[model samples]
Target chain A: MGFLGYRRPDGSVGIRNYVAVMSSVSCANGVVNALSREMTEIKPIIHTEGCGRGLADIAISTRTLAGLGKNPNVAAILIVGLGCEFIKAPGLADQIKPSQKPVEFLVIQENGGTVKTTRKAIEICGKFLDYADSIKRTDCGWDKLTLGLECGGSDALSGVTANPVIGVAADWLAAQGGTVILAETTEMIGTENILARRAADPAMGEKIKSLIRKQEKLTKDILGPLAGLVISPGNIEGGLSTIQEKALGCIIKAGNSRINELVEYSAAPSKKGLVIMDSPGSDIFQLTGMAASGAQLTLFSTGRGTPAGFPIMPVLKISSNTELFRKMEDDLDLDAGQVLAGKSIEAVGKELVSLMEEVVNGKQTKAEINRQDLLAIHTVGPAF
Target chain B: MQEQINAVLIHPSDNVAVAIREIQPGEAILGLKQKISARQNIPRNHKVALVEISIGAKIIKYGETIGIAIQGIEPGDWVHTHNLKAEEI
Candidate 1:
């Protein structure tokens, strides 16, 4: 059995056909949000940084915006900008032009005002969606799937059930020649040695180890002893203490697959297999990075449960326990709690793969159906 | 063969098990030899030491050392922030 997806001009397959309405800077967010509210097919990508920042900050903001538009799930893009922002709307559109997707831009200051820009953006989006609708879904090979693995509100059961079970599914997808992205750089602190050992070569292994060391040192330097309290209170209440325990549970979601490459935040993986993305531990931030990096969907495991999903793709929620699954039936999609009930990890993992097939074939997850289209980009360095 | 699984020894070499459900104090943990009794109220999803561990000894879970015991812990003692330091605070 194969999943139905739309093949893009760049040779990437998209599970969802969406037209992105994005703000080049925080100033254009209102117009982007207005357009998103008018149409279900248009996803609004809003963020706070884009202008009046350091060079590094501006570059990351620009790169991330370009990546958002470049995501395979996005069929076309409409960039909304304030004329004076450092990251220009037309320039960002130019970055995505290589994909040969329909791209348009409007500047609020260059036009009459917010009202004029909103109207022009809406008109452009209408055409983009019409073009997107004409593109047909074809049955695609499993190798086309690029999955993002994440876990939040984690507990002990997350490691014992959800994470490990999701790991099985991740390994299965990688074995089928699909790409699996593992994120949360902070969570890699305590388990660096184990992960580094799995790297493709000694240099890649050193890279993994060095990245962990730098992230740990940076957090400690900034937050002092508070850095050790990396795990949330919910995690503690759910029986995890110290960054090490949470890191241990968090690493399992990547499965037992070897680390193929380490990519920077929001950067697409050039190779397949288990690719580690250097992203922060925040759920929405990491989810956004993964989506921007070209993951068609996400496999998010949670013990405490979260309702957040990405703006342009499906986020399949797997609950660690039967109780949370029962409580959040409206938000969660799969139940790894069966693993706790004596079912094998392999069995639940197979079930997860079938669920992924259903999702790729146009089935909306609970979060998608509820329209929990949350998004956030990782920003480094301070805005001036 | 399966008995009531109230706790899970994640790895064969693990010296601790996570409680699947809350185990009340003094309840005999079934499916284990030597008849270990819950020394205190072990909450659901929390770890319980399977053997007496001396101070500074490593606390093993998932067959890896998650932390070190800050104080001496007896079998079935709830191993958490109080008794175990995630690696010497």
Candidate 2:
């Protein structure tokens, strides 16, 4: 069954409708947090990388922050900033103006101080919440949904059970005209050829190859003797013997769908079906990038268990093994480990899809219940 | 007749299977058409060679080459970092 979602003026769909307060630079995070603490209706977007960075990181930060503001999940947004920071609140708010949502900006230095800026933010955000609350959820089709695929803290069962189960659902969603995003270029190592071959066209296939190739080389150059050459003793001890084996586990979450688009970090998909966003393998950065790309929800599987959720999007956690599922029952959403118990992959996938429906239809996941609102932006280069 | 499954064949084209539970030496490696007994103590979640693989052959799992076998691998041989080498970038 389809779910009820908030439709944006730009025709995008959102599973959640929240009034958000974001810090344009790290200096304003204190005020942003204070506003959220004072107003329970505001989802706070806090981060550490708004300034004191090279141009590359600034570009990434600006794009990511704008993407998060423009994300359909936020019905309204308030940007807070320090006047002297590289990424100012007005500039960031201007980038998100195309969304046609209620937007406001505050400068801590100009607004008197943290206390004064936060007071004004609370007033503006309170009005935004009122506007947000007036909107109602409408029926949305699968075509309006974009689900992101992610996996972290993995064990061997991640590939055999959780990721493959996610794959089946990913392919099913794509077949139904919904969008699925596969990210984390760091985990796409050694399987560049395999993934590229599934691209929508030869040119996109080449792009996929080069994107993964660049990540592989960077991994080697930066993590020499630590990555790319051999499985670490730690990895071997944990039962994985090769980089491909580890990487294969991650890529399976995309299923067999043809990758229709490849977007840069935090860029929105221009097509449906499966898309790959270039992001770090680090869990928080990938989650935030996918969220900023306008994914309404995420399908995150873990073998070792991670309680990571985005500020606005819902994260449905699936466990790779039955034991971990039992151990982390309160934290996980689905149990794919039944595949090892003789259940077929398709069966668990269907179950996962059903669970996904419930979550999208306003069911609170464990992460949401625990208020696991984590956010981070991927920085491509050194600071200062 | 049904056989007890102790390992999982991730893909039909795969030449190796991952043991769902530890397999003792001489125990039959399930999930393969040809009966292959574990040659040594195969750790849980570790790969077992379903077919005898000569050295330098591509090690297949999920129906793709994950790496290359550095040493000749017998059926039910435990594949790890020592014998399985990662593919070069």
**Top of the candidates by lDDT:** 2
Clashing pairs in 2: none
If scored against the real structure, what TM-score would every candidate get? 0.86, 0.91
CA-based DockQ, model 1: 0.35
* CA-lDDT, candidates in order: 0.85, 0.88
Question: Candidate 2's interface RMSD, please?
Answer: 2.1
Per-residue lDDT for A107-138 in model 1, tens only? 99889997788888878988998999999999
Candidate 1, residues B1-89, lDDT tens digits: the string is: 34566776655567788788899999876544557989999998888888999999988865567888989999989999999876642
Q: Which pairs clash in the backbone of model 1?
A: none
Best by TM-score: 2
Q: Per-prediction DockQ scores?
A: 0.35, 0.46
Measured with C-alpha atoms, the lDDT of residue A85 in candidate 2 is: 95
Q: Write the per-residue lDDT of candidate 2 for residues A63-126, one digit (tens) a residue.
A: 9999999888899999999999999999999999999988899999999998889889878987
